[model samples]
Target: MKDAWKRWGAEDERGALNLIGPDEVRRAVSLVKSGEVVSLAQPLSSKTPGPKHRCGLQHFMNRDGGDYAAGGRRPGGFQFSEDSVVMPLHIGTHIDALCHAWYDDELYNGFAGNSIRSTSGASRLGVDKMPPIVTRAVLLDFVQLRGKPLAADYSIGRADLLEAAAAADVQIGRGDAVLIRTGWLESQTGVTDVSFDIEPGIDVEAALWLAERDVALIGADNYAIEVLPFPAGKVFPVHQRLIRDYGVPLLEGLSLEEIASRKRSTFLLMASALPIVGATGSPLAPTAVL
Candidate 1:
């Protein structure tokens, strides 16, 4: 891992989120012209394509009309239904907390890797520590540029990001959120088609570029933020470098087709992760106000 771990200070837990301020938020709001809210999350279900290591969400209603049929009565004619979801926090579109990845026995900002215990979860840098992210976000639609799904195991590099940003005519400044659409998530038809063994994603070069820009968040419409088949001599190196070394979180499994169709490359993004204390990540139904 790079020696870039402590840029935000030893005790700091928010990481790159510290870059966001009043100005960055205002810049994002200025881009909201039409006030159209576009959902950027894939609906969670037993059918959503995901790695076999974790089972899909198992949802069930806790209260419903079925209760009425079972001799239940409504008080004051009031009726309501409630449901519960049981699954990994990373079931669908989600943000990785800085504690999600680590190397060399240390987490982001030098938090001891042992601080993350199976019994208690992360003692520091858990998803609960993450604040709601509101900022300017730019979409780099590589799908339209490539005219198809990025080839399996494709590696997106710094130059590719620069080209996309140039074509979109947007500046990827400090504190901006960059969402890259590879058409990977949209291409999935079912669980049978999902493959953790391969996917198109960013490489170390692209990750470093974003980190240097001090981006508050980096999201993509894919499984892992980095390319699959594990880069030669690397195992999820991007995740380690960004999350553990640079304090940048990864947003994965997004649904960007709607926003891309509108032909607006820049917009105001608002995302709040589930305040899951000590968890590594949280599912998010992020919204883009275009």
Candidate 2:
């Protein structure tokens, strides 16, 4: 696959997102019919650890005194509660930055991968550089296509994606956000033994297919958007090609069960990554409006 670095120019960092312009946003807005909204994020819980070890969320609460209202007119008049949370940026449903993966030594736009790291985060292609994504979104429900949940190690290829799209009667348009439903998230009862070790996802061929279509982003219900333990002798080849070569961001751990159950193939997707400077990814609460 040819790299898109020269196509987007040297200083470009946003990658395929650059395809989403005012016309695309307007087209997305035109797709809204009922104004119904569905959240695409899994709820954060302290009891359940994330897919990765040591990435669980921790919560703390601070409460005002019950009877001692020193800065209030009455003892019970001034009561407030505050809370804080700590977790990895990629703990929940999140989008990976262009700097998140690379081939050997170079990142997207030919930046030195090793030289971009710092105590704060990556100096180039960080998550903060990604703008809010508002565009036409299409759902390719693989579970429905297979008539059952795919096997944990199933690797979806280019042909599978095309067949699913045709079956759903959805058009894969340029600058669109494509979400794939494997039914993996719906079958899970808890985070433990969720099969993070292996799960169904797109293969390198599918990655190249999406790149050819000029997709802005790709998301899936599974933890990683691409198959784990990849094809023989390949190490995260999908990630390397999509993020480092095509500059397409990947969305993982999405909550697509509700939308999948509804059987809607097209919707308007809106997700804005937090401007956390230097971070490789950002936890997001993406919403789909139907």
Candidate 3:
């Protein structure tokens, strides 16, 4: 293979002999302490979203600056910064928590209001219910496998996923944190103002396929995992199937070109997102190390 690893075997080989397993993930976690941290967030920028886009993040007041009095002596330097923000949690690079979705008003893991504590507000299952996740992650270079970016309206199916795995020569295991790279994130250049639209994304069946495989989470380089202009006029069937039905989290708006460059099947995939209580989603930055 043109991208085969040296230790894996000769270039003519179809697959690697040494595949990464769960033990590798445990060893990487053991090397880090509680305070030892890693940053995995893409900076929110005004330039990224175009003029037509609406992000209402105008500069208010920084915690470091401003005094108690009205426009009085500022404790810290009074720096005026500006930002644009929107309330859509699905906007930008974010991870959808389990509580972010519901089917028939019921959440994942079968959390019921009847079992809630007495004083809680409406006794709803929130993202806080999700415990810390530590699992094996597999990066699928879907774009590369297709020899181009995924079609704008291309429907990603289980066959495409299997083809990507075959092209990458990697085997996915149960509970794997699977990340699919579509190269769409790379197309969002400094000059381009890429707007959101219903485009290429996976169908509900594909979501069920991953869930049946017992995947812990599924991520993609696109805003929505399923192709846009969803089939049957559905908005986000992938999200509905995964988070609402299976309770699997979603990581979106990833920049995976650099990570996918190294064709290694086994690696320490490290990622962290903000622990915003009750929020539907939060920004994230995940990395894969060989």
Candidate 4:
């Protein structure tokens, strides 16, 4: 385990944070010694930005002569510029903290309130409460399990997940973060644009299955982890069920190519979500260690 920690570069925050305790390291060692494999989940993002996509701001200050600094140094004489961006929470590779979604305006176990709040309510479980998710992770390669890539318009049911797990020689477990690879990340380059016209993901049964297994999180390599073009006016029942009903987090738009390529089971699983107090979600780089 100590040896593994040494392999990490100083610039790797996730790896550095992971080295804090011996427990995670020991567990990782045990898995490796026992021949277990590891995988990382990628957040789904688009090349084309949308209303719900990611946005960022850049503040610039010219050192020669453009912006103004509070210090009043003439290095710039003038010194600041700002820019803004807008995008959906679902864009890029991100994790949907417990506050990411809600039920008929209520959250899991029926919290109160109308909007996302910091207290007990449907929108109360903001991303701020999400701690670092360091646990055992198992990858379910639906694409490989199916002997092909997940169809662009594919529908994943609980049964399909069961089949995928079997193919991977893995089983869902309590507190386990299950990452299902649909191989959809590769399709990003092929699409002319990122469209909501994309597909739906796991069905209700699969949602229930994850809930039943007591999974901490469920992730996939697609925009939304359920079949889309929703039947009628359904606004992502799967997300609703997991976040609002089961109180579980969901990760989407993950790139599992590296993990899938390993074709092994068990590994050190580590991931993070931004500690944005009032935000619904944040972008992050989740990784796996062998």
> Which candidate comes out best when scored by TM-score?
1
Worst 10 residues of 1 by lDDT: 1-10
Mind giving the per-residue lDDT tens digits that candidate 4 earns over 94-134? 77766566655555444443656446422355666567877
Lowest lDDT 10-residue stretch of candidate 2: 66-75
Per lDDT, the best of the predicted structures is 1
TM-score of each: 0.96, 0.93, 0.71, 0.73
What is the model-wide C-alpha lDDT for candidate 2? 0.86
lDDT by residue (tens digit), candidate 3, 101-204: 55554455454424333354223434443444555667777777777877677787888788877876777766577887776666666636475674466777
Q: What are the per-model C-alpha RMSD values against the true structure?
A: 1.3, 2.3, 10.7, 9.7
* TM-score winner, 2 or 3: 2
User: Candidate order by lDDT, highest to lowest?
Assistant: 1, 2, 4, 3
**What total of clashing residue pairs does each candidate reach?**
0, 0, 19, 31
Weakest ten-residue segment in model 4 by summed lDDT: 10-19
Q: Residue 180 of candidate 2: its Cα lDDT?
A: 94
Model 1 segments beyond 4 Å from truth?
Answer: 1-3
Per-residue lDDT of candidate 1, residues 37-152 (tens digit)? 99998888877766788888888999999898897888898888999988888778989999999989988888888999899999899999998999998899999888887897
For each candidate, the alpha-carbon lDDT, in order, equals 0.89, 0.86, 0.59, 0.63
* lDDT, model 3: 0.59
